[model samples]
Target: MPVKYNVTERKNLQDPQAAPKFYASAKADGEVNLKSLSKEIAGGSTTVSDTDVLAVLNDLIKVVSRHLADGKIVKLGDFGNFQVSISSDGAETAAKVTSSLIRNNKINFRPGADLRDMLSTLKYEKYSR
Candidate 1:
């Protein structure tokens, strides 16, 4: 199936006098949850149950979360890499920094080679509202 995108006009908030620019935004056809994904993977093998796939997937999530919390970069082979990132206010001096200076924390995912190549291989279709 071809991925769908729509042309959107976005204004530059930083420059009010600038002309609006056009960009291609992906038009989502639908959302697939973990249950649906497990079912799809199980379809190829008649012996594997969806429940088994789901159980393994659940364990994967837990393992990833635990390792990431421990400040370890989790690499899922060709799938991707997951790590933690933090944003904090700058300190006047190295000794002045404290826990209160820390502002935000987030998990960052970097796609592996196979996932990154999908952008060039996938077909696209223009979507109109």
Candidate 2:
């Protein structure tokens, strides 16, 4: 199954008056939740059951969260690296900056080589609504 996408028009934020640019927006066929993913894993001739897979996946989430909270980066082998990033308001002086100045906190994911390589050979088809 090829990835599907639809043409979308987006306005350039830097130049609102400029002509809208066209881009390809991913058209999701459906989302595979943990249950579905676990079932797929169990479909293989492996001893691991879906329940055990789910438990491990759940623990992975918890472990990643704890590490990120501790100001540590979590590297999931070739999958990617996860880390916490912050957006803070600029202060006039370095001494005036404080934790309170931090406005937004987010998790950033950087795809690894395998994922990047997959994208380089990605196949897509136009999807109609």
Candidate 3:
């Protein structure tokens, strides 16, 4: 399926007084929750049930969270790698830098080869209400 997008008008934040520029923004066609996603996975295999997929996925989330808290990068073979990233306030000296200065901590994901390939080959379509 092609990705759907809609036209939008955007103003440059740095120059708000400038004329608005037109752009294409991706619009979500829909969202799939765990149960729905599990069912889809189950359909691709004969041995797996939706419930089993859901249980494993739930456990995956917990396991990933635990590993991340331990300062480890979690790499899912063909999916992606997740790691914690942070920005911090400038420190006057190396010795003065500490965790307290850390801000805007976030998890960052770098797409794996399979995902990168899929993204590279994606097709798009303009969406209308």
Candidate 4:
């Protein structure tokens, strides 16, 4: 009879492909899209269909607007909070405001406990020469 361990020995495992290269490629694509969007918006010569932009913008507006209207805080898992905070006096001066007006309603999401625990428990192994 032989003793069995739950953890697999490192010597029996295969090496994994590098993940950073994939992440860099994805990030580069996002940057390219942003630059193209900026150029189109600035040039004004290229006509972007209103329906396409409106659909995306409206979806975003609906999420925030609905949550605020319902007086509920919208929580996005792994992201931090969105809530409506009120200010009073209608004065532009920060010192003069005293909780009289519903000045801004925003979304805030605090990361869930499970996500925090998982992040905290992450471990890395170093390869020896």
Give the best candidate by lDDT: 3
Which residue pairs clash in candidate 4? 79-109, 80-109, 81-108, 81-109, 82-107, 82-108, 87-101, 88-99, 88-100
1-129 in candidate 4: lDDT tens per residue? 122223222332354553322111111111334445545554674566545555555686688778877877767655545676554347777787665555554455466778778668755433222
Each prediction's Cα RMSD?
1.5, 1.5, 1.3, 17.2
Candidate 2 lDDT over 1-129, as tens digits, reads: 889999999999999999999999989998999877877888783899999888888899999999999999999989999999999999999999999999999999999999989999989999976
Please report, as a residue range, the 10-residue window in candidate 2 with the lowest summed lDDT: 36-45
How many backbone collisions does model 2 have? 0
Local distance difference test, each candidate:
0.95, 0.93, 0.96, 0.52
- Candidates' TM-scores? 0.90, 0.90, 0.92, 0.28
Candidate 1 — which residues are off by over 4 angstroms?
Answer: none
**Which residue pairs show backbone clashes in model 3?**
none
Each candidate structure's count of clashing pairs: 0, 0, 0, 9
> Which residue runs does candidate 3 get wrong by more than 4 Å?
none
What lDDT is reached at residue 119 by model 1? 71
Per-residue lDDT over 3-53 for candidate 3, one digit per residue giving the tens place of the 0 to 100 score: 999999999999989999999999999988999999999999999999999
Per-residue lDDT tens digits for candidate 1, residues 1-129, read: 999999999999999999999999999999999999999999988999999999999999999999999999999999999999988999989999998998999999999999999977999999966
TM-score quality measure for candidate 4: 0.28
For model 4, where is the 10-residue window of minimal lDDT? 21-30
Of candidates 3 and 2, the better by lDDT: 3
